[model samples]
Target: MMTSAKREAAPANGRRLILFGAFDRHNFGDLLLARCAAAGARTDIVFTGLAARDLRKFGGFHTLALADAIAAFGSEDADFVHVGGELLTTTAWEAAVMLQSPSDTARIVALHDRSPDARTAWARSVLGTTRRIPYIVAQDDLPTRWRTHFRAVGGVAFDTLPGAERNEILRALRTATTLSVRDRTTFDALRHAGVDTDLLPDPAAATPALFGATIGQRGQGGEIAALRSRMRSWAAVQLAAEWGDDATLDRVAGSLLATSAASGTGIVLYRAGLAPWHDDLDTLRRLADRLGAQRPVAILESAHVLDIFALLAEACAYVGTSLHGWIVAHAFKVPARCLVRGPADKAARYTDTWCDVPRQWRTPEDGPLFPETISG
Candidate 1:
């Protein structure tokens, strides 16, 4: 460790900071939240997210769904519950307030979403951790992003060894490896504290098994395409029926491994939420035939939870409908082209989250990419 500050160690237990946000959607911020909130103990990721994959590699220390979360933690026993990220809608705020494991959970809601104003006092009052840790981690980058609409007011910069501040941190965090800033000052401080851990790539794979990436790539486009192409040649592609779950994706994947000679181009046409839309099996067959036409696709059902990330990462190029496919494809830097039900649908939230990553050339085709309704 040689360059900057210390990693934000998850605070001691009983001092757990429960964060509630829209983690189910697979958006960048959601992924970032899922990846970041597990820094300290007693930490639980309460999400309304669509993903059911292993988040530990992506920093999911302790995760629970909102429906199953109430029993997991109540509002009367903890020191505080810090509101995480820029989520301040009525439901999000309400959920954030209720996530406290203690009834006396002091709400230290960060002003990251919008600064606390007199008008929002009621919402702020509902928080449980403010009294214990009123201080907000409003980093330098945030001020520039929110100079006018909101204010940090009395907050600190977000440079608390930010996982995504630089490549090393991102890679380490992404892989779930122990990471300290790569500078002498930071390393010496931790070493003196008797905390030494070997560094390994975060278990979350960066390069897809079928892609061209020999290195780190997250937000870059060309890198993803190359990676996907690489997977197309090396890894097994599970062409799941667009409506089947992850389990079907696995079976289809198994079929590829079993039937096809290992040319590294096995694809499964897995289906997720799309199964219900088709009225009959024949219609689904027709649709799947068309959807799976351009590339080599085989009909498979949606997959189970555990295999989604690995299965997607194993592929170099993912041409599909599900948001998870797009995300896993993009995370490994595999070139992903989505045929989302709606152009700017909620499913697009994940892709859209990282949509701004690659610097795309301006063209008539690009106009649709930039949603006009959001161009305020």
Candidate 2:
């Protein structure tokens, strides 16, 4: 565990650090990554994302636009840290759409879906970057005095990226003073492209060690408190909205029902991310409705990042599609099972690289089941 003194220590010679990532949105993992990076920093850190966003209400930082951040601090001698996430394969289109409000996402997506030229223009306009990979900044993007570091970032789908985009990412990574990836698949792909990177666990793995006390405090009140009081024991459940179809929900509900019956644990559904294309509260509510009040099922609709962490920290086990949720559960030594569409999923890749636990892959006949490792 890092002591407060160590964590609060200023950077050597008082150099500033620009912590950059896709944290401008409400995604749980991105916000958590920003928190982890900030907690571990030994310098004055400025959070930067694609757009200027004040997400503090959700326990995220007041992020400045990356372009604005560069203009404001680029001239200074600062260290640029690309805070860890699945940033490598994120296209400008995806990042642009995810950065929008949920209500506006559909309209923007629809307007640009059929027009490749319009989509490209809109993505570049929204992200304010012309780089093929907008999220991964190249050395030339910053001042000559600035140094770059890519820390524990993941790109499980990097191999599938277009040749031009892959080259663009490689060019940026080559200039990093320190580069590390979070999974073997990503590391292997980068190595195949002649970019050497250290393979480290996702930074979120250290969540419990760094913020367990804070998370515990958060659970003592509000929705977390009510849920804990209502159910003696519960499993934290989360899944992306894409899994909300009738057949899929039915399978998932059946599995949850069986697990609840067998272990006498209630179900607590939480949204891992509220950004466009992320988890949906309505999807979770639909799942709750399917559970049919037979077992104690509660939907945690809070968008505050710590609330999600608190829910996970207090749970006996976790079953979710969110890799960060599984990672946090593992950090707390709480048994967890990640639900994935297939073995190629990012969650599967991450767990395969760093975990001994088996992840559940969704099948037509059966949804994800509770890992047998979770004893009643």
User: lDDT (CA) for every model shown?
Assistant: 0.34, 0.85
Per-candidate TM vs. native?
0.35, 0.94
- CA deviation > 4 Å runs, candidate 1: 1-12, 17-266, 272-284, 291-296, 321-324, 340-376
For each predicted model, how many residue pairs clash, with residues at least 3 apart or on different chains?
Answer: 73, 0
Best by TM-score: 2
Predicted structure 2, TM vs. truth: 0.94
Q: Which residue window of length 10 is worst by lDDT in model 2?
A: 1-10
Cα RMSD (angstroms) for every candidate in the order listed: 16.1, 4.5
- Compute the lDDT of residue 66 as modeled in candidate 1: 31
State residue 254's C-alpha deviation in candidate 1, in Å.
26
lDDT of 1 at 89: 17
**Candidate 2 on 1-376: residue-level lDDT in tens?**
1111111123356678888999999988999999998896665789998899999999999999977887888779888888899988899888889988899988998899999799999998887788767889888778898888888899999999889999999888887777888999998898878787778899899998889889989989999999978998898999899888988888889988998888888999999898999999889988999999799999987979999999988888898889999899888988888888778889888998887644443434443477766544
